[model samples]
Target: MPDLSIQLLPGLKLKNPVIAASGTAGYGDEPNRLCDIADLGAFVCKGTTLKPRAGNPQPRIMETPYGLLNAIGLQNPGVEAVIEKYAPLWAGWTTPIFVNIAAESVDEYAKLAHRLDKVPGIAALEVNISCPNVAAGCLEFGSTPESAAAVTRAVKNATSLPVIVKLTPNTSDIVALAQAVESAGADAVSLINTLRGMAIDIKKRKPVLGNITGGLSGSAVKPVALAMVYRVAGAVKVPVIGCGGITTGEDAIEFLMAGATAVEVGTAALVNPRAPIEIVKSIENYMLEWKLTEMSQLIGAARR
Candidate 1:
């Protein structure tokens, strides 16, 4: 078999280059029932916060042609509850669990990092800076290089674990944003978070989602995501984890060729629980047909 293992960071090595995106696997309990968590390179838990969030109102998810729109609003139990409940369970699994955290303030981000630092079973942190910073009048921390760097610095100061800043495609300059986070101590970076989108209910004469607007994801966003990953990869020295609309091994390979060190399977897993594993298999098959010996040959093959 082709070697599928990869080192995402100095200390964070994954058996494969496929991660189960945050929220899709819901802390790994339910998904484990549908697919083996051990098969994934890593699992990012639901987007977490300092406090438990009820999330946005119902009718929050809508399916579009080859895409998914969600305004779930970071619904998650408080960090303490997650540590107490899921940490124990994660400690026993062979797969590393990365806690994906979001916060409204810089302090909250640091605190979340501090709380999870040195905790057993938790291998790393994936900071979700796409959230609104209430202190900045609802401006998303990821909207600017300054705010994004602030969050990255805060989290780095508070934790010893590797920090993977999950970048938002909503930014004006994604390459700059990636560079900012990388300088602020991000060990790796992942992108692009869902694009802003909405739908109108033609029959009801109203919006489809209660939140009115939500993040757009799935195969529809693949092209846009591929472009951003390619740009950011060239801009930063840190590993880039490509996400958005990746539904198959072919999709994963596109990101890899575009310079992604790994790929995150999000909406596809919601469509098929076995998507991640299936993608891994397909990548392996491709490597075999091409006679590739290691992941390095594929990590940025197209860049050449």
Candidate 2:
């Protein structure tokens, strides 16, 4: 090991900064079979709602040029089931487990937060304020500062666990939303959730995804994600978790340089379940090559 640990918050210290992004990694069970999730810093489970959702219709995903477009619609087994089934299993693991939560209304978000707070295995809460595929409350809360803040405040008030607000890239002013969540009492922030995008089947003259539009993620969105993370990380005092199109350790380094205290791996896990593990190794190698030890030594070094 290369002293990869980092303190994302005063009390929320991580073994390393490369965590598994939600949706792609299913509550640490699926990937744990292929790769020991305990090797990574932490992993956020798929988006959980107050009630179960069937998600959108079939063909909810489409392959794009450099990434994948998905509209999972926050499909989950509901918060109650999540705790009943996985909390005990997670409690034995050394790696922290943060549950990614999505809800249609502010009240639901708060209620879900309160419920998750009682779960013994959960490490923290990452509010998914940026699910653009939804037509109702999630999209509404994430698209604007007021609604975003409303959601953030509700969850913060409901839970004692550290709350990390995940910001949507679909907004005109991401910085404003970042600040809003901070003011509303978020402990940290994660930026650049997949960009809102669509793909069309030219020959069929129709959209590829059943939802018509989906979130764009993968190596292609790195520049845009990096720019947003850089802007938000510098602007907010809260630690920023950089997510979006990160497929390699080199990409992870770029995000940390851009000012992200940590980074999350999403789409890459789809291609290779071992990507996160490989990324962890790659990061350790980078540390050795640069004669660095602590992962904190790389964070925001580019900005300074």
Candidate 3:
């Protein structure tokens, strides 16, 4: 059988390459009830902030043809609450947990990372600088290379934990963003965090999402994600984690071939709670059928 394990960073090693992405996986708790949480390489919890946020108003989510749009506004019970409530129990779980964090300012990002630095059971910090739903400290930092590098440098300096900067597809040049983060000390990068999109209620003649514009994610985004992974992976020396529309083993494999060291499951898990687990099993089956003995053989093959 193939060894699906991948070392995403110097100290952050995962048993497999399939991880439960932030937002959909819910603090590493809900999936444990729905499927074998152990099947996941790691769980990137929802966007944790400095203070609890009420999130956007009603109509925060709207389902599209093969996609789901959301402006959840990085809603969570704040960083301190997450540490006090979930860290202790997560400490016992074998699967690694990464707290996804979103902040309103560069200083806030560093502060959140510093706080999480002391929290046990937190395998790493997934810095979310690309949340389009928020009014501030969101896409602005991620859209520009200088600002993105600044945030990465800030978070990296604040935490002892491995920092994985999440990349936004809304940028003009994703490779530049990836390279900037890498230079600024990101341990790894996860790409394609929902493209900016909107939906209209023809009957009401108004926007369907309360926030006006939301992040678009699901099977519909797989192609765009694949392209970014291919481009950014080629540009950066650090590990790249492909995320966006991955739902099946083949999709995961496609990303690996495109040079992604790992994959994150998001909207797919929302549609089917067991999608992450199923993806893991399916990947193993694919390796068995193909007689592939290691994941390294798949990763970056397309680029070669």
Q: Report per-prediction Cα RMSD to one decimal.
A: 1.7, 1.2, 1.0
Q: After best superposition, candidate 1 residue 97: deviation in angstroms?
A: 0.7
Residue by residue across 8-110, what tens digits does model 3's lDDT show? 8777789899998999867865535777777789888999999999899978999999899999988899988899989997999999999999988999999
Tens digits of per-residue lDDT, candidate 2, 62-82, equal 877799999988888898899
Q: Please report the TM-score between candidate 2 and the true structure.
A: 0.97
Which residue segments of model 1 deviate by more than 4 Å? 31-33, 131-139
TM-score of 1: 0.97
Question: Sort by TM-score, best first: what order?
Answer: 3, 2, 1
How many clashes show up per model?
A: 1, 1, 0
lDDT of each: 0.90, 0.89, 0.91
- Cα misplacement distance, residue 199 of candidate 2 (Å): 1.4
Q: Each prediction's TM-score against the native? A: 0.97, 0.97, 0.98
In TM-score terms, which candidate is top? 3
